[model samples]
Target chain A: MSGQTSAAVAAAAKSVHQDEEELHGLLVPDATDLPLFPLSAVESNFVAYFAPDFTKPSHDHYIYRHPNGLCVVGLAPGHAALRDEGGVKGVDFNVGKSDRSAIKVTGKRKKNAQHFEANTMLCKVSTSVDTYVIRCCVKGSLLEVNEKLVKQPGLLNTAADREGFIAIIMPKPADWLKVKSKFLSREEYSNLRVESL
Target chain B: MVAGSEAEEDLRAFREAVSLVPWHVAKDLISREVCLHCIIRLFGIREPAKGFTSLSPSMFSDIVAELPSTGEGLNGIELGENKDKNDDETNEERHPAPSICSVCFGILQICKVNDAEIPFEKNGVNFLANVIADAVKEEGHEFDSFCVEVSTPPAIPENDLSLLSYINSKYGSESWLQKKPLGNIISLKEALKALVTGPLETKLGVNCSQGTFRIWLTYKEASPLTSCDDKTPVAKRQKTDCNNKNTLVACTTYGLVAENEATEPCVDSGKITMTIPTDGFGNGIAYHESSCLSKSREPCSLSIECYRDAVYFGGRYLKYSRNVSQTCWMIDEERMGVTSVEEIISGCILPFCRGDKSKFHAAGREDIDVRMLGSGRPFLVEIQNARHVPSIMDIKGIEEKINESKSKLVRVKHLKLLGSEAWSLMREGEAEKQKQYAAVVWISRPLEDRDLCTLSSFKDLSIMQKTPIRVLHRRSPLEREKIIHWMKIERISGSSQYFVLHLCTQAGTYIKEFVHGDLGRTNPSIGSILGCRAEILQLDVTDVKMDLF
Candidate 1:
């Protein structure tokens, strides 16, 4: 093979290997499912927000998901890219700054930055069709905006891929305000939205 | 008329045939006086013309004063004046009063006629009465056949010795023989004969037949006899003053008084009265009402008098140290040196002492040699006839006196004053009573521990024992059963063992021989059990118990 074609093939093989490895990880039960909260999350001001009309409180809910339905969500620190109407860089996301790009998660999630880094993966993500994993991050006032979902990126577009892709993806919310209120504080519900696709 | 005269003649013939004897003799023989009088009154009457022909001479005299005056009188009547003067002088000289005889007819006459001597003074009337009563018994005479008579002595002048001399000259002498004339004088002879054969034969310090007699003539003025008139009527006599009289009759004049009062200030006043031993030695005068004497037929005056004599003679110092054996030892002519238990009590100085016989009881007996220690064995010594009875202070003295008097072969201890009932228990029971014993034995060889073990097994075992040969002379040959209560042994010197064997057995068991086995007479004995020949070294009695009052 030529060098460029060999490099592309080698990268694709590495990515497939990584996916296969993550798929194995998703099949096993996680420590969080066994009722073990991480010591770092308990120390920080990591609050789980509930929707305003949620039947049960947020702490009672044992399962959490990413907006892309790619991974189970757990406490992590990260920055989310904020864009104006036209997809443009607005501000750098940090833990304490209050800017348009800075998102404030209310309730117990607001204080998570002191003890935990902004972007960290706490649990594995598994699904019926495809397995995706996500890590949460902390912005100044926003939490879901900074999350990253990793999915099986490229494969031949087969029937199994489409079905697996739909099975693994988190359903998108009809009302972003309600979703935000469910993930963050009610006071910040108007300013932010949470979507899982 | 001729027939009537003929009938009278026949009656005279029949009267003379019936009247024969003198009136006095006939009166004395027959008891019925009226029958004699009726015979005389009917036969002595004569018809008026034939008076002399019909009556007998004695009968005719008796009825002569009763006949009516007859026309034909006798011509031999003496002149009245001359007869009257002679009768008057004779009447003045002789007092012709008739008195009943003092002597009863049933009693054999002991006095002679015209014998002035009294019957009692020569031989005590009451004493002779007893003797005569005994003699009558010996002769087999019935009790009512003889009557007793007490004769009164003729009055004797106090100052006139001449009257006594005159009487002595007239009579023979004042003797028992002279007083009773009915039989031969045999009292002295009989008394002497009895003295040889009687209880006096064993009495010491007394001659069998020794009595003194003396004869003297003296005049004695007698008291006048009291008169009892037939016609005067019978009345109870009042107490009379006899103080002025020279002589007073005891029973009659004194009229039954107490002896002390009767003989007050007499010679017997100062002496104590001796009482008789009725229930044996230490027993006092058994009262008439006493149950012991209740069965006696007659009142026991002899017992009473004997008690009086014993009390009177014993005086103040009574010795009660000796055992009260009922009988005394007798040897040949004397009662030996041993005095009777009664005599010992009687001779005791104390007037009122009492005691029972001495009994020897031992817890275990010794062979006459071993002495008892530990308060000299618990024994009871019953003191008898204790005059001057020891007070608490005198008990020690009395005990010392007894110990001093006896030989060391026998020792008396635990001296006590016991009642009469205690004596009865000792005398009445069997001698073979249970006793405990301790004996020291000398073995032919020393005993081993095995032998001692064998001896210990003999405890609580019963053994049969034959009489010991040494005491066979006094005891019957018989087998006796004795129980061994317990035993303990101690080793003494070589070949000698001191064995204290306690046995509850009949009282008279020979403890010494029992230990040694009496040459095998006592089977299963200490010697036999140990399988060794043993001999008694010493035996001692440690305790004696008798249930007594």
Candidate 2:
């Protein structure tokens, strides 16, 4: 439920960095850098839209990118599950590090290793309006994270999709092609922002 | 009068009252005190009794005090005169403290139910429990255990006119079950459960409301279904009228909830569900006003009805006739002589099994025009109330019975008893198994044998397909990938343009779409493979590779 355009974030940025270039603030909207694809099925209540980075970093690991959008993750008291390595802040993880997380494949469940439909909550995202949980829409191996965004969170506001990548997801060849097909390209997303306004 | 005979007399009087009065007027005449006593008797919670289920005594008394009441007046209700028929204004009397007893009894014998020593204020829970405990001996099932299930009459909720008022005054879009049902109506299930559990366990030699052999005690006080009710619209209710009296005793453990109109026929056969696998035995008792007030006899009519639990059996069916379908196929509610694979088999075996209803579950189904030929398609049939079988059934005899269909519509083999686990295996096999089909293909031009040589090389090749047009209305339009394992030309015996193809495909491959190409909705179809147009004239399941026994 939490959502805002780069322009809106820039306006809100009027308070954060008044002296910074206003044109740069509005022109590079990181929040808009989300990956989403609609499934080719009836929109039964069962269907979920996935919007996160999914790039293969190397031969073995995949990446799940955060939308160039910065979500205010809660680090409230008594909540110990979401501890950042350095107590960095909010939902952001360790900065300046890009590493592939190893995944274990066992049991008969690995047959559909490329697909993810069963859901699990990874973290909570709080926007100015509301809070929404960032969930794994389907099941698959999560291979890597773009630690670069943690150190340079501005990439989300500036270069959202390409440089503002979040984490990597490992899906088989067929599923990868399908997930990639649903994402809106840079030009299309720009047009969408203009039309939405 | 003997106490046992008196309870029977009270039952006779109750039946008389039901026959004599309209249920709505009767609804007013039967007081909460009577309901409280009757519920206690039926559940047998206050005292342990043979044949009857029991709950704790104290809880029963506590619940009675909290039961929604017309509040205090017990003398106002008059059944025979029907004097208070101020129809429109009477609706406002949502809570009528029915103090008068016109029926549910014939002659007051002053039985233990009306003992002077038992305080009327505390209710006759203790005394009445003792009397019911003596009136009958316990019935037994050969099964190891027993359980209790309560089914309240639909008419119980009909009395809750105040519920609408409460909703309008309260918040929007909240479910009533979240709060009190229909305003202060104590749950019959809870009341019965609290009253019967402990007492029943000590007496029945089996756990009450705990095990698999469940006995459904349905208390139906709704007005009898008329010829008109058949055409009338009912939202969600499984209406079965085996006996005129509303009470039924069923031994079915099937989940009983009537679905809405939008529901898909739960079985693949696509027929509306009307009954469970077994029929419930119904016993009805009526009461007269004076017979009800008489304490010697409890008002109940006992026409003993017995029901047996459903049994499971399975077999592989071969549909030789292409004119038949796996299930009934009709358009605009009209049917031809075409019998479905389910109908032929259910018709043959249901008679021997003597079940009220039979459900059909198969590995998969073929189109109405297609035929199932090879070893046959595996299926599981659950016959409700199959009394004869748990005693060594003759599988070959059943196979012969199924093959006796006049039209030779279908044939069944490997008929055997199946367990619950087979249902899931049938489902899994349908979704994930490989299938081989023989199709009669007609091409636009004569095709040489060499032209189809590329078919032998295809293996685990994936192709994209969109939902075909014929099924577009039923299925969503979506792009899905299916695999084609291999294709072979089994025979080129037909005309120059006609031939046969033996194809092995993934579980969900659209063979017709693959052959005809559905205007390129299916890529690399037989049409695409050969540089010519191809369509299937007839198709048959050569084999379904589900080795599940």
Best by TM-score: 2
What are the per-residue Cα lDDT tens digits for candidate 2 across B1-549? 125444334333333323322232223324323443332222222322321222122222232333234532223333242222223133224333222111222101112232233322222333333433333223323444555544443322221211212221221123321232222333344454444444445544555545434444433322222111221111112443322133222111111222222322222111101111212221111222232133332322111122345566777888877788787777669874378888888777777765667888788888877777766799888886453454445666778767875677788878888767778778877788888887767666677878668777788878888665356433444568999898887444324665667788988888988887654557778877887767676677867888864
Residue B402 miss distance in model 1 (angstroms)? 2.7
DockQ score for candidate 2: 0.01
**How far off is residue B395 in model 2, in Å?**
3.8
With candidate 1 superimposed using the best TM-score fit, by how many Å does residue B25's alpha carbon deviate from the native? 23
Q: Residue A17 CA error for candidate 2 (Å)? A: 85
lDDT of each: 0.30, 0.45
The top-ranked prediction according to DockQ is 2
DockQ of 1: 0.00
True lDDT of residue B449, candidate 2: 75
Q: State how far residue A196 of model 2 sits from its true place (Å).
A: 54
Per-residue lDDT for A35-149 in model 1, tens only? 2222221122123332221222211111123322221222111101111122111112222332211332333323322222222322223332322222232211122231112
